[model samples]
Target: MRKIIENYGSILLLLLGIALGSVIGLLTPHAVEYIKPLGDIFLNLLFVSIIPLLFFAISSSVANIQGENKLGKIIGLMSIVFLVTIVLASIATIAVLYFFPVSSGMASAGVMESPTADNSSWGDRIVKFLTVDEFNNLLSRQSMLAFVIFSFLIGIAARRAGAAATAFTSFLNAGNEVMKQLLLLLMKAAPIGLGAYFAYQVKTIGPQLFGFYAKPMALYYGFGIVFFFVFFTLYAFLAYGRKGPATFWKNNIVPSLTALSTCSSLATMPANLDAGKKIGIPPAIANVVIPLGNTLYKNGSAISSILKIYVAFSMLGWNFFDWNTIITAIGITVLVTIVAGGIPNGGYMGEMLMISVYGLPNEAVPAVMIIGTLVDPLATILNATGDTVAAMLVTRLSNEKFAPSST
Candidate 1:
């Protein structure tokens, strides 16, 4: 029992904190404001750490990589896996909504304030989405995708420079280690940090969940549970057959809980990175894929987009099943999910896409946006932990010989 506790201490503590916070939120809904700041401090710490962590982790891994083609192959396979899984998530959500359906007759919903709106052309928005206007913009958490691109470029350039860049490579590696240790120290506070955040979330959002949001929330969460357990299990199995699932589940627990509590993919990146190492993925793949996944991965985003669209349709009395509308909505969801994660105000951007494409009223934005908020915990779990499994699949497909847990 002592040994078990020793091994599982962090997760046990995390779960306990979450349970306690949840109870507090439920029993006393009026006090989350005081608790919310504790959570914010933790999240801010995570956000601040991410840029350096991405820079070092990705650049160092890529710089240390041996064969040039190996990196290319890993990325190619990783893209395919990301796309396939996202499509599956989106389609699955559509299927469930077909059977279960999500309608609230609350088409008149509107927020006290409007979401951020960008009037830029699609071509311009796409360009800005991937590349920033200046170097300083890359440092912001909002420009994560751009920073990832910058880091990847730095890695590729360094790798090409060969022996000339060896000293720089060492610096990158050292920085990665330092940032990782910092993350470890940061995680020591997660039980309190995330527990506080979860309390606020439950207190503020709990009542809404029980109201008109219940039906769609139920549908989203029902599918989320299946996707988290069943599909993730299947992906693990495929990555290494029988041994894969056990390895994944073992290393994945803390990351899963972290995502559930914090509802932030970037906040969960360190745990995913650790899990990737334990799961035997090459650092080149894990470093690039996990961080990149935080910026661009679509499993959770895809499902959320679909549900948001369905809710709007059902409320507006439109036939969501219209083959053309379904096709169009799914396409929009995929596009939004793909591009939305990297930018500031991404959720608002996604809402904009849904409203514009479906030609819905502005009021529909807040209605569906709440769904994203309510479902964020599970959605983030899928987004963050899915990166670990993705790295496994990429390793296998790239011929890297990843045999489950290495630890």
Candidate 2:
């Protein structure tokens, strides 16, 4: 039906792209390599827009937080909840790994020379993050965290600009809207671009990639499902007591499914907004929190980060169980997930951070990318679901009526 197609057209196209790419790679890999450039071009286009988009979107959101009373309280509560969820996700990842330990053989046996490895201590890494050249950092993907920090500060300054804050916030908001429109336009080519990319990926890595990672991937998904049910159930109970569980699922199933199909929290925002209304969340809270959570609240991403770190350390024959390493991994996972964008393959940025901070082998970069891409949809489902639950909690804590009483 036209309605069904309209509702799910993008996801269908992406799925078709993936399928076609796999077939081409399997049957005529030599020919498929020629089209790989299309995928690269698409990725390049996305990378080009990311920095400005981050600045506008993140800064504007933070700046606007000043306009609403108790919005800060909502944000404060949400922050604690978000951090708790991420920590829980990390704990789940650790527990899963204990039961289904990743084999060392998942890593390529060949040794790779890492060009980015350095002798910087954790303190040095922190100092470097806070001391980057602002203009230069904005122009480079390698300085994403630094750029994020700069954006946050700029947003706070804009918020405190008194009467001038309104115009500044409007300008940044317009820019953010324009960037999102640009991304949507580029996504129209996703079928062709992502298909080509996947074809080349299959050709280069072959089926063996899946075979080697099967157990680990399975473990990730299994634990992810457990986390989703456990956390959301508890969140619902806390927000609305007995009726909360049913209401949460009733309203969120569609949004969760949309996120799963698109692997994009940003794309699922409209549906989430509608779901928030149906569940009695105040429009003011939903407007602020859903968008903010899209960019910052990434419990799913935190779990993925933790999983990737575990795999990377296992590959490198490092002691993952050491207290120091465990604590450091938790810190890195929290930070990286906070900065992860809501686009497909957005976690690639976080993976890069992991590599730089943890001294992971350069070869592990590609492996992490591949793994993250493969699991993006499920991760996104958890992310979208969490956003809705967050809205519920915000509604409860702010003591707002869910819906207006019939006049």
Candidate 3:
């Protein structure tokens, strides 16, 4: 049984969460009263792990990347890819909202926040809400960006300090390793947390909630999956001319599976590296691109953020055409979401962050949560594929020639 769970844990837990959530949605009458705490617990648990995990993983990964000679150019191109992918995601989200507008009443009907009489004006409120750290605070109420920034500083200091920071680096590396193990252990409880969270969400919201933005959500997810195929095919055509795409999946499926099972690009690094090497990607290219990909290749999560923003705007009856809002949403999504693609269970947290930033209706929060739970697997697949694509793209950008036996 343990072996079975280990093999099929993520998928099994995800399904069980959905089934339980749906049942709860179907049967529970006052889901808001009882389900809130459960959602909070799951989110809290997930958030507590994010900062530590990101700090060590990103700092260490970045350190390893910069050690490479052509690292500057590689990092630049990867950053561009990350930005462009996020923009595309934002566009896809806006398009979904425009195409299938969910009624505002669906969100406004049931809840109430005490109206403020001051009316300090929308401009003032917008300015405050749009602050960078404010959005981070909204999600986990922790300073994720600060933590990441500090981690980078520590990594740089470690390299510069030589032996002084050696002991520190060793400790951090060990902490990261231990935390990874803890993550594995924490994931064992995902089914229970997800089940409770889902049950609470669906039990309270009911199936009708799905109809609001379900079509658009599906479209967003479909676009990401389709991109994976398009990118893989393009890589095949470019690298091997007419025949490469045919064998791309054959050599890379194991990495993809590992990515799916693990729900992390970083976690699947070994496999991705192995697959890339098998396909003639050199150690130089693999070493540089794979790690950078972890920080700047969140095509899946980016797309989800875009879609969620649109949904939120639609539910709030806000003009979706506001350039400032659109631009800001895209910018935040791009910057914060770059590395988030590889994070297990990150999409939901991302949605919460975006929603809070926009001051979206509280009623719509559960809807976004439900979507996150449902789409985690697809998100995992896209995150993995995005990394592979980045590796190929970065290699091409760096003009690195791959030999048939390069691995």
Candidate 4:
């Protein structure tokens, strides 16, 4: 009991926090504002950490991988698979959300002011949009594209420096190490943060929110799992053949479970690396893919985008957005997921800003935040499992592609 508690301490704490918050909120309704500040503190802590964490983790990983010649093929194959998986996950999420639909027809819970100020004039809005950095500062403070562009520039410079770049590379590597430790510390506080957030949500929103919202959230999570199986597991079976899902699960399940239980994909890295090797993926590929995948190619965030859109349509009874809107939403979600995947708590602010860009009604923001906090552990499980499967399949396909040409 003690061992299990120690092992799963982070997840346990998160849930405990939620449970406590719910009870307190139910008992003292007026104190909701007091607990709300805790949520703010938690979110601020997470936001401050995400950008630096993502930049170092991804930039350093890229620099290290460049030292290996075979990495190009590995990256190319993995990127193709990653893109396909995200597209499929997006489709699945949208389809399931459409079917399960979270429509309540009820007005939003409170008299909340619009987060956005009046865009009364086209010129004013255009001016704001044209100066994107200014708009982003107003919106979320952290811009995903900006982060990616910055990281890409640093990574390119590091790669070009060759032998001379060792000092910079070491700095990034050290940053990664420090961030890993800091993430663990934050995760330990997850229960408290999640609990406060959860309690505030439950107290303010009540049980009806779940009845009205749970189906779509469940559909979102279901799509994530379905894509993990279809894209990752199915490809593994085709590539491995004699060694199928059974074998892949045998090798990767422990780490997947660890990721789910702990809700920290970074913490599960050593386990995932070991699992990848056990499943017959080369050590070089495993080392390269798992860390990089953790930094990018987040399958779960793709599903979140689909789910968020669906909720917006259902909640506001807004006119169905056009195909261009859908495509734009999916595209932005994919880009943000890649850039922000490495950051602890990066998704919150990014997605908050995304709601407006996608033309989603702001009423959906609280619902999305709730989903982000609750669904994290399960999402991490699906992501890690999917990544391992993709790595194995990519390795097997690369081997076959280069094999002797029998004319």
Residue-level lDDT of model 4, residues 13-130, one tens digit each, is: 5556666777887887778777777765765665566556657755776677644455577778888878887887776666665566666333453233444545457476434432
Q: Alpha-carbon error at 391 in model 4, in Å?
A: 1.5
Query: Candidate 3 at 291: error in angstroms?
Result: 2.6
TM-score of candidate 2 against the unseen true structure:
0.67
Clashes of each: 0, 1, 5, 4
Decreasing lDDT order of the candidates: 1, 2, 4, 3
When sorted by TM-score, best at the front, the candidate numbers are 1, 2, 4, 3
My TM-score estimates for the predictions, one after another, are 0.94, 0.67, 0.58, 0.60
Q: Please, what are the lDDT tens digits per residue for candidate 1 over residues 138-210?
A: 9987778888989999999999999999899999999999998999899899899988988987887677778
Question: How accurate locally, in lDDT, is each candidate?
Answer: 0.82, 0.73, 0.59, 0.62
RMSD of 1: 2.0
Model 3: per-residue Cα lDDT over 1-407, one tens digit each: 99877645565656665566566656664663565476557545655765666566545544544353554666677677656655765676566556665443346433333223334565764344333444345333233334445566666667667667667777777776776676667555555555565555454334443654566556765676776778557756665656467556655665564454345555555455556666666555555456556545676677667666665666666776788988887876875464253455655546655665677656667656655655665666667665665666666666776654422
Report the lDDT of model 1 for residue 274: 86
- Ten contiguous residues with the weakest lDDT in model 2: 109-118
Which portions of model 4 miss their true places by more than 4 Å?
Answer: 1-69, 104-106, 110-211, 343-345, 400-407
